[model samples]
Target: MLNKSEISFSFVFSIIVMAELICGSVESLSTYHYFTKPSILISLIFFFWKHAQHLDAKTKWLTLLALLFSLLGDVFLMFVNASANYFISGLLAFLLAHIMYVLVFLRKKKNSKKVLPFTALLLIYAATLFYFLKAGLGDLLIPVIVYMGIILLMAITAFLRQGNVTKNSFILVFLGALFFITSDSLLALNKFYEPLPFSNISIMLTYSIAQLFIVFGLLKQS
Candidate 1:
C-alpha cells in the first residue's frame, strides 16, 4: 500500500493528467497542452528521481533521461502545426526516450522463450499499422519504421523482465509497455491515417496512465 506522501503525490499528478486530457480533448483548449503536457513528464521525472536514488547510477540516469526526452517530445509536438520539422523533432525525441527505456529494461534481465512470441506479435502489429500508414508517411517512411521498431523492442525488453524481477514489477512494466503501445498506435493512426474520433482524449488518457504505470513499476523495485 502507498504511504501518505505517495498517495498525495499520485493525487496531484492525477489532477494534472485529467486537466491535460480535458484541455487536449477540446479543439479550442488544445494549445494548453503546452503547459499541461510537460507538467505530466515533469512530475514523473521528480517522482522518479526521488524514489530512484537507491538505484545504480546507470539505471537511474537512463530512466531520468527517458523522461526528459519525453518532455522534449511533448514540447516539440505542440509546435507541429508550425512545421513538419517540429513533428520530426518530436519523433526523434520520443525515439530517444524509447531507446532509453529499452536500455533500462535490459538491466539484469533474464533470457526467456516468451521473447519470441511477444516479439512476433509486436512485429505483426507494427507491420499492419505500417501498411495503412505507408502511403501517408511520405518522407517520414524510414523514421516512422525505425521509431516503431524501437518502441516494439522496448516492449519486448519490458516483458523479458519476467523471471528476473518481482512478479509485480514484471506485470506493471509489461502492462505499461502495452499501454504505451496503445497510446502511440492511436496517435499514429489518427495523425497519419484517418483521424480517430476523440483521438486526443484517447491518446492522452492512455499515455498519462502509461507513464504512471512505468514509473510505479520502477518504484516497486525499491
Candidate 2:
C-alpha cells in the first residue's frame, strides 16, 4: 500500500507518460515532427525530479545526465534530416546515456553470473545484425549495426553487474531498452526502405512503453 505522497508521485508520472504518448501521436499526424522527442525528454526530467528525494545521489546525477543526453539526441535527430550523421550523433549520445545507466547499476551490484544470459542474448543479436548487413540491407546497415551494438552492450553490462538492485527493476529497464530498440529499428526500416504497415503506430507504441518502463524502473530503484 502506497502512502499519499507515493500515490501522488505515481499519478504524476503516469500523466507524464500519457502526455508523451499523446505528443508522439500528434507529431506523427502533424507537420511538427520535431516536438515529440523534446516533449518526451522534458516529461522524463519532470518525472525524475518529482521523485528525486527517493533516489541516491549517484542515481540522481546519472539520471540528470542521461536526460541531458537524451535531449541532445532529440535535438540532433530533429534537425539533421538530410544525412545519417545526425542520427549517428543522437545514437552516440544515447549510447553514452545507456553506459551511464550500466555504471549506475553496476555500482549497485557486482555479481557476474547474473549477466550470463544477457551476454548470450547480445551475441545472438550481434550475429543477426551481421547476417543482415552481409545480406546487403543497403544503407540501413550502418545505423542498425551501430544501434544494435550499443544497446546490446548496455544490456550486457547491466546484466553482468547486477548487485543491490531489485530484479524487477532491472528487468523493467532491460525490457524498456528492448522496446526502444524495436521502435527505432522499425522507424529506420520504414524510412530507408519500404513503408511497413502500422509503422507509425508501432513506433509510438514501443517508444511510449520504453519510456514508461524506464521511468518506472528508476522510480522502483529509488
Best model number under TM-score: 1
| Total colliding residue pairs, candidate 2 | 2
Per-model C-alpha lDDT, please?
0.88, 0.67
| Sequence-dependent TM-score of model 1 | 0.95
**Model 1 clash pairs?**
none
Judge candidate 1 at residue 51 and give its lDDT. 81
Worst 10 residues of 1 by lDDT: 1-10
List, residue by residue over 1-222, the lDDT tens digit for candidate 1.
455766888899989999898887777987786788899999999888888877889989998999999999989988888999999999999999999999999994789987998889889999899999888988999999899989999999999888887777778788999999999999999998999988888998898888888888877754
lDDT, candidate 2, residue 30? 47
The ten-residue window of minimal lDDT in model 2 covers 27-36
| Residue-wise C-alpha lDDT for candidate 2, range 91-155, written one tens digit per residue | 78877777676666565565676577767866876676465444545665676676667767666
TM-score between model 2 and native: 0.75
List runs of model 1 lying over 4 Å from the truth.
1-4, 27-31
